[model samples]
Every structure is written in structure tokens, then in C-alpha cells.
Target chain A: MRTILILIKKEFLQVFRNPLLMSILIVAPMVQFMIFPFCADYEIKVLDIAFIDHDGSRITQDIIHSFDASDIFVSHGIIQNKKDAEKMIQHDKIDILVEFPNQFEEDLMNGEATRIAITANAINTTKAGIGVGYTQEIIGGYMQKFQEDNMFIASEEQIPARLNLSYIYWYNEQMNYKNLIVPGILVILVTLIGCYVTALNLVREKEIGTIEQVNVTPIRRWQFLIGKMIPFWILGMVEFIMGLFIMKLVFGITVQGSIPMLLGITAIYLLVMLGLGFFISSVSENQLQAMFIVLFLFIIFVLLSGLFTPTEGMPQWAHYTNYLNPMSFYMEVIKKVVLKGSAFVSVQTETIVLSVMAVIVNTGAILSYQEKSK
Target chain B: MAALTIQKVNKVYNKTVHALQDITFEIQEGELFGLVGPDGAGKSTLFNILTTLLLPDSGDIQILGMDLINDYKQVRQEIGYLPGTFSLYPDLSVKENLDFFAVMYKSDIEANMDLIRPIWRQIEPFSKRKAGKLSGGMKQKLALCCALIHRPKILFLDEPTTGVDPVSRKEFWEILQTIRTQGITVLVSTPYMDEATLCDRIALIQNGKILGIDTPEAIIEHFKGTLYTFKSANIFSLLEALKRCPLQCNYYPYGEHCHIAFYEDMETAMPQFLQFLEDNQQEHGDIEPIRPSIEDCFIEIVKMNRHE
Candidate 1:
């Protein structure tokens, strides 16, 4: 234990003494927190759209007003022709174009219904689908209102039935996407930095030929591994706190969960990360190979860990594969604690999984660490 | 008393590459033993095995009368090792690194200050500086201090002076001499042939094999023939001429001269060699019978061993 403490102290001195690394550790979380949240949103808003109104009548104008009043679409100026609208769409300036047929109002009044065509950029299939659905709803509402005021239809019947979706976002009540993302992002960042840094720790010593010095010493494998991991574990904690503060103060996102519960899960998460790093170091021949392996693992964990999408919503194979992902479990626990205010009992299953993973990885790492000088 | 003993030790890395093969040697207590070999000559492999960092495939190693494998923990507690490369934590202050190693051995710097005081005092002013920022010589001194902090019974230095400047290399050896006088068993390995003389006894190794083991003076004294240092303006031609001459001698180029080992007596051979050089029009050259250095003996042994 004393030897482990010494190793930990050495690791801390190494991390803190390098000014550039220290600054990167502190500032990266804040910068990522500030920038990433703005880019992350499940609900589409302020979609730039263009319209070509051939009808140019009051009914068509009212339909356009409905779209304007809705927060989802921000209408650009009316295009002179379909060709011009197509040009704007092609240039990527407009995400969508709504065009009406000629004499649409006259035809509609004469009992010949007019049809409007809507075109959308389909590259981002999800965003395009939502944008198109919102625009169609607004136009449908305007037509219903016109029919009722003209007495062409009964007022009661003219009121189209709308499906009222009381979206009870299970974990995050306010549906703040940042709250959903912050926890997962924090997990990934810590895993990337923590695992890579610690993995390279011993390998760097080996490369420079200093590992022989340590190998000949009285320090045991477990002590050395613990010593090397503790400082990074503490650094990981600091980064977690910094990320939370940024989310709360800068983004105004509230943490509804117990702080101690969140920290407990975070501690488990860091152990798993550090253990993985030590395992990589044990297998690697040099620092370069160690770093490469860490990066590859980081990429795999971040992408497949259900950080960007719901694990359940993913394909059956992907969902099952995520069971092996330590980051997936960590993200789930963090989100539950910070957003759902979950207690230890509430997240007991996830906590146990993380604990099991920590034990397995750490044991493997220590066992793999050759205590000899070679 | 034997400080260390290895019997029929063999190390085959990855089950194919033979790093150390059938090695057997021992160092006496308080002896400054050297393992002299070129790169890839298994000096490091032997060091690693003795230091308990690597397990030999089949061998019995006894260090200070304790089984090497069974008593590894005790062995580790009593050895100080400096590897070929600088392995100290680069980001930690010099003092911090020293303290860390000291703590690992369950010893305090204050308690052992006197033991490392000689070396520590030289680097103490820059103790606050990060080890990565220190000069090569300062780093070497710091590593030596860390290794000696616990005042172990034995020290293992693997090519400690390889990349160091000549002056610092000399200083390092001087420090080693002092440590030796204090009765610490020091086993150092180096590719520098000149350093062989510094050791009380050396095992000349090549290709994972021990060529010879003896005091440098004894090894030189045992060299079997009259040796000559031959140099001319055209040294290459001189070497070619001597190789082709009907003298029944062993000749190989050494620096700017062809070192020739002749079975003939020096008194009869020197005048003939001079007359032959004059007849061959070789000018501005000299030939002299000289005492063989460890390098000369090493070459001779390697050559003789290859033939046998």
C-alpha cells in the first residue's frame, strides 16, 4: 500500500508538472461541454425554407403565416419560380421548398381541390422527415380553418382531430438535450484521456529503459498498478466535476440526482477505465503501440457505447454488443443519477455491472503485468 | 562469499530467439564484475535474469546464498539497478523521483541521506527541476542516486555510460569505484572494451555465449603469441600484404593499423618485417611489438573460439 501510494504520488507529479497537459485536462471538458451541447438536439428547429406561391391568394398567404408562426420553420423570401427554388435547395441555402399550383385558390373554390408540392433535402433523413411533417400539419390546419369560415363544412367537423403527444421524457423531464448528452460525453472524455494517459505511463518507462529500475525494486505489481492509476483516477474526478459545473452554471442544466451517488458511479467508471489502460500497457512493447491501442479502444467505446443514440433503439446486434461496452453502463448510470435523481438501489444493477467490470479488468491488468525486469 | 551465481541458465525469447544460452558464472561479494559484449550479445538478458525481471527457461540462480526465483522479493529489496536507457519519471522533479524510489523501498530520504549524500549534493541545487529538463549527465547522476538510495547489497548497471559524454563517463566510473570500496557488489555491463580494465574480473560474451572470463590483466597475459601494431600510409595495402605474407600469422585490421599475431619470436620477426616493409616500398610507417589490451585479447579469443 505504501509502494502504491508512492507510485500514485509520482504519477500526480508527472501530470501536474507538465503545464500543457494540465491545461488540456482542465480546459478540454469546459470547451467540449460548451460547444457540443449547441450542436446536439433531437427536435429540429429553425429550418430554412423557401416557398413559390402560384396561387398568391389570401388562403395561401394564411397557410404561409401558419408556417411562419410555428417555431420549426424560418421562411426565406418567396422564390419567383420552381427553378429558382430548386436552385436555392441545390445551393444548400434552403432545406425545404413549398410550391403551389397555378389558380389553386380558384380551383379550390370551384370544388376542384388544389395540391401543393413540398420538397426537402433528404441527406439528413431524420431532420428532413420532421421538417416536412411540421410544414404539412400547418398547411392542413389552414385549409381546415378556411373551409369552416366559408361554411363549406360544419364547424365541429372542420376542426381536425390532432394527436396530442404528452412527451414524458423519462429521465430528463424538461427534455434538455444537453442533460442527456453531458453525462455520456463526460464518460467518453474521461475514458479517452484517463485510459490513454495511464496506459502510456509504464510503456513510456519501458521505452526509455527506466522500467528496469522499477522492476528491480521491492514494489509489487499490484502496488505499482494502483500507484499509477490513483492519480489519473483523481484527475478523472476533477474533470467530472468541471464538466458538471459547466453544465450547471454555463448551460443552466440542473442535476436532479444525488451528488454522492453520481460521484460513486464516477469512481467505479474511472477504475474500469484505468484498469483497461493498465491492461493495454502490460501487453504493449512500447509507448507508440500502447497509445495506438488506447486510441482504437476509445473510438470503439465512444461510438458503440450508446452515447449518441439509444442502445435499445439500435439494431438488435448493436444493442446486444453494447452489453460488453463498459462505457455504455457508465453512461446509463450517470444519466440516471444526474437526470432521474436515482438512488443507489435504483441504479444497483448498473452499479454492480460496473463494479464487476472494474474487478475483472483490474485483475487482468495486474496479472498480466510481469513483475520481472524484462 | 558468492554475491550471485547462475548455473546453466538459458533464455529463449518468444520460444525462438535465443537471447541467453547455457550461461554459467558467479560474482564474489564486493567484487566489481563486468559483462563485456557488443549489442545483442546477451549482456542485458543475463542482467535481467539476475535482477529477477526475467525468468530463465532452465537454471539455478543463487544470489547472496538465497534461491533467485524463490527468494525474488528479498533479492529485489537488496539490488539497485540502472538500465541502459534513462527510465526515471521525466515529469517529476529530480527530488520527487528520488523520494518515490526511496518510499518504494520503505525507506525515507532523510534516513538514507548520508548514503546518497555524495552524489545527491552535486544535483541537489536542481532538485526542484523536472527530470526531463535535466542534462544527460545530471539525469545519469540522479538515476544513480535513486538506485543507491536504499543502500542495497548489490547494484546492477546495464550500459550506464553508453551515451554519456567522455568526462561524465569517467566521473561515473569514479563514483562506482567509491561505491565498490564501501563493500557493495557491483555488476556492470558495457560494450565499451576500454571499460573492461575497470572491472576486477570480466566475462567477455558474444552471441549469447561467454568467450572468456578472467581479470583483464590475466586475459591479456594469456594471449598466446607475439603481437605487433603495424601501420603505414596505405594501411589497407599493408593489411593485404601481411595477410598474404608467408609468416603463418593471424592478422586483422585494428583502427589505423593491422594487428598481427605471429607464432614466430619477436626478435627474429621484427627485423624481417622491417626489411619486408622497406622492400615493398611501404613508407612513413612503424611496427612495434606491444602488450595486448583487453580489446586485443577479446578479438583474439573470439577468433580462436570461432576456429575451434
Candidate 2:
């Protein structure tokens, strides 16, 4: 135990002494955290829209005016014909096109249904999908108001009966993309800091031949590994807490669950990640090899971690593979606790799995480490 | 008592390169032992096995009468190893590296200060400096301090002076002598044959095999032929000329002279050798019999084994 403490002290001294590494540990994550959430946003904030208005009536003008007034669509004014609108779309000047029939206003006046064709570019599928949804909501709102004002004049038989739909978003009421993205970014920040640092530290010793000196000592393999792991674990926690502050201050995401519970699970997840780092470092002979291996696994962990997209929507094989990914479990637990104000009972299963992974990977790290090679 | 005993140790890397073959030797307590060989003669491999950092494919090694393989945990507490390379953390300060290794052994510098005092005193002035920034000699001294911090029963130094300046190399060997005087058995490996003479006893090794093992004087005494050294204005031309001469001898360029060991009777062979050199028009100086150093014996032994 004394030996382990000394080793930990030595590791911390080395980490603090290297200014480049210190800055990378502290600064890179903060910069990435500040930049990534806004860049990775899935919300379609702008849809460049153009219209072919065959009917130059006030009703068509009002519908076009509504699209212009909204925050999401960038209205390109009215075009004379479909050919010119198609030409604009081909030129990449417009992402969406709205076409109205010559009888569109006349049909609505006679209490008959008419169609407004919405042609959305499918190149960027998500933007196109969400833009279509926004368009329908705007047109629907305009029609509802139109019906209420004109309902008293229309005969009861001509008026069509409709089933009204309403929605209430439960957890994220405003559907703020930042709230989801910020927590996911926090998970990545904590993971990269923990795993990348730990992985590089040991491999560096091997590269410089320092590990051979340490290996000859009386220190137990696990003791040395734990000592190597502890300082980085603390660093990872520090980065995580910093990310939490940024989440609240910049993104306005306050954790609704118990703070201690969040930290408790974060500690376990760090163990799993650090163990993975140790495992990689032990198997690798040099820093470059370890780096590539860590990068490959990190890519898989982050992409499949359900941070950017919902795991529920993934294919059957991908969902099954996420079970092997520690980041996925941590991502789920963090989102639940932060977004839903979930208590310990709700996150119990994920916590248990993370704890089990912590044991397995750490044991694998200790076992794979050869203090005496064959 | 035997501080370390190895009976028939063998190591084959990748089933092809025989790194150490049938290696067997022993060191008594407080004795300074040397494993002398050239760069690729498997000295580092032997050191790794002795330090519990590697496992020999087949061998029985006992250190202080305890099994080196099975009792490695206890064995580690009793041995200090300075590998061929400078293995201390370069980013760490001299003092920090010392304290870190001391703590690793669960020992304290203050408690074992006397053991490392001789080497530590020289590096203490540079204690604040990072090890990587230190000169080669100072880096070695700091490494020595770290290795001796635990005060192990035996110490392993593999080529400690390989890259050090000549003055520092002498100082390093002197330090080894001082260390030996403190009753710590030392096993040092070096490629310089002159350094081999400094050890109490050395095992001459080559091509993963032990060429000879005994006191330096005894190995010299065992030299088999009449060795002669003679200067030549053109040593390379003399060597080419000698290759054509009909004589039973082993010859090699030694510094500015050619050293040849002849197995035939010298009285008859000497006159004939001079005539042969004259006939070949080889320019040479007076040839005189001289004593063989450890290097001569090593070359002779390697050559003899090759002939067999």
C-alpha cells in the first residue's frame, strides 16, 4: 500500500511537470466541449425554401408569407414556374420547394380539400425530414386559424369533421437539442480524458525503458497498475466535474438527480475505461501502436455509444454490440440521471453492469500484464 | 555460500536464435562477478533472467539458495538490477527518481543512506535537475543510486560504462569496487575486455556460449600458444601477405600491431616465419613474445571453439 502511494505520487508529479500534457488534459476537453455541442446539433435551424406560386392570390401569398415569418425556413421569394424552381434546386440555392395549384384558393373557398406539393431535397435526409415536419406544422396552424374565423359562415354539412392531435414532450418539454447533446458531450469528455491518458502513460514508459526498471522492483503488478490508474482517475473526475459546470453554465443543463449518485457511477465508469487503457498499454510495445489501438476502440465506443443518436433506433446487431461498450451504459445512466431526474432505482441495472465490467477489465489488465515474461 | 547458481540455463528466441545455451555459473557471497562478452553475446538476456524480468526456457537458477523462478517475489526484494539501457524516468528529477524507487522497495533513503551515500553524494548537487538533462556519467550515477537504495543482497549492472567517458568509466568501476567492499555481491557485464580484468572473476561469453570462466590471471595462464606482437608499416598488407604463408597460427590486428599465436615450436617456426615474411616482401618490425590480456584469451577461445 505504501509502495502504491509512492507510485501514485510519482505519477502525479510527472503529469504536472509536463506542461504540454497538462494543457492538453485541461484545455482540449474544455475547448471541444464548448465547440462540439453546437456543431453536432441535429436540429434543422435553416431550410432554404423557394415557392412556385401559380395562384397569385392573397391566400397563396399569406401561406408563402407564413413560411418567410418562421425562424427555420429561409424564404427565397416566389418563382414564376416549376421549371425555374427546379433550376434553383439543382443549383443548390434551395433545399425545399412549395408549389400551389391555380385553384388552391378557390378550392378552399368552396370548402373542398386542396394539396400544396412539398418537394424536399433528400440529400441531407435529417434536415429534409425535420424541415417537412416544420412546414406541416406552420401550414396546419394557418389552416386552423382560417377555419375558426370562417367556420360561422360555412354550412354545417360542408364543414369536415376532424380529429385534433396534441402532444406533450415528457422529459425534455422544449425538445432542446443542447440538453441532449451537452450530456452526451460530457460522457465523451470524461471517457477521452480517462482512457487516452492512461493508455498513453504506460506505453510511454515502455518506449523510454522506464517500465523495465519498475518491473524489476518488489512492487506487485496490480499495485503498480493501481498506482498508475489512480492519478488519471482523479484527473478524469476533475474533467468530468468541470464539464458539469460548463453544462450548467453554458448549456443551462442542471442535473436533476443526486449529485453523489452521478459521481458514484462516474467513478465506476472511469475504472472500466482506465482498465481498458491498462489492458491496451500492457499488450502494446510502443506508444504509436497503443495510440492506434486506442483510437480504433475509441471511435467504436463513441460512435456506438448512443451519444449522438438513440440506441433504440439502431439495428438489432448494433444494439447488441453496445452492450459490450462501457460508454453506452454510462451514456444511458448519465442521460437518465441528468435529463429525467431519475433516482438510483432507475439506474441500478446499468450501474451494476458497469461495476461488473470494471472488475473484468481490471482483472484482465492485471492478468495480461507480465511482470515476468515467458 | 553461493549468492547465485545457474545449472544448465538455455534460452532460444522464436525457436531459431539461441540467445543463451547451456549456460552454467555460480557466484559466491560478496564476490564481484563479470559476464564479459560482445554486444550480441546474450549478456542482457542473461541479466533479464537473473533479475526475474524474463523466464529461461529451461534452467534451474537459485539466488541465495531460493528458487529464482518460484520464489521471485521474495527474490525481487533481494536483488537490484541496472539494465543495459538507462531505464530511470528521464522526466523525473534525480532526487525524485531516487525517492520513488526507494519507496517502491518499501525502503527509505534515510534508512539506507549509507549504502548509496558514495554515489549519491556526487549526484546530490544535481538532484533538482531532470535526469534527461544530466550528462551521461551523471545519469548513470543517479541510476546507481536508485538501484542501491534498497540495499539488495546482490546487484546486476549490465554494461554500465558502455557509453560513458573514459574518465567516468574508471570512476564507475571504482564505485563498483567500493560497492563490493560493502559485501554486496555484484554481477556486471561489459564488452570491454579490460574491464573484465577489474572483476574478481569473469565468465567470458560469445555467441550465446561460455568461452571460459575463471580469475583473469588464471584465464591468461591457461593461454595455449606462444603469442607474438610485431609492428608493420602496412598492417593490412602484412595481414594479406601472412594469409599466404604456410604456418600454423592464429593472427589478428591488435591496435597498430599484429598479434599471432603459434602452436608450432617457436624456435623452428620463428626463423621460417621471418624468411616467409622476407620472401613475401612484407615490411615488419622486431617480433617479441608478450603476455595475453583477457581479449586475447577470449579471441583464442572463440577461434579454438570454431575450429573444433
DockQ each: 0.70, 0.81
lDDT of 1 by residue, A1-374 (tens): 67777677677766777787777787776788778877877767679888898879877777777777877788896888778788888888898889888898888787665689999998888878988887787787777667767775344554557555456877766777777777777777788667877787778777876666777888777777777777888888888888788778886767787898788888998999899998999899998899889888787777788778777777888878788888888887877787778778888898899999999999999989887634
For model 2 chain A, give the 10-residue run with minimal summed lDDT. Answer: A153-162
Name the TM-score of candidate 2.
Answer: 0.95
Candidate 1 Cα outliers beyond 4 Å, as residue runs = A54-56, A77-80, A152-174, B14-16, B108-114, B265-272, B275-279
Kindly list the per-residue Cα lDDT of model 2 for residues B1-308, writing each as its tens digit: 99999999999999999999999999999999999999999999999999999999998999998999999999999999998889898888999899899888888899899988988899899999999999999999999989999999999999999988899999999999999999999999999999999999999999899988999999999999899999999998998888887889999999998999999999899999999999989888889999999999999999999999
Docking class of 1: medium
Chain A vs. true chain A, TM-score per candidate?
0.91, 0.94
- The C-alpha lDDT values of all candidates are 0.83, 0.91
Model 1, global lDDT? 0.83
Model 2 chain B: ten consecutive residues of lowest lDDT = B238-247
Clash pairs for candidate 2: none
TM-score for the second chain in candidate 2?
0.99
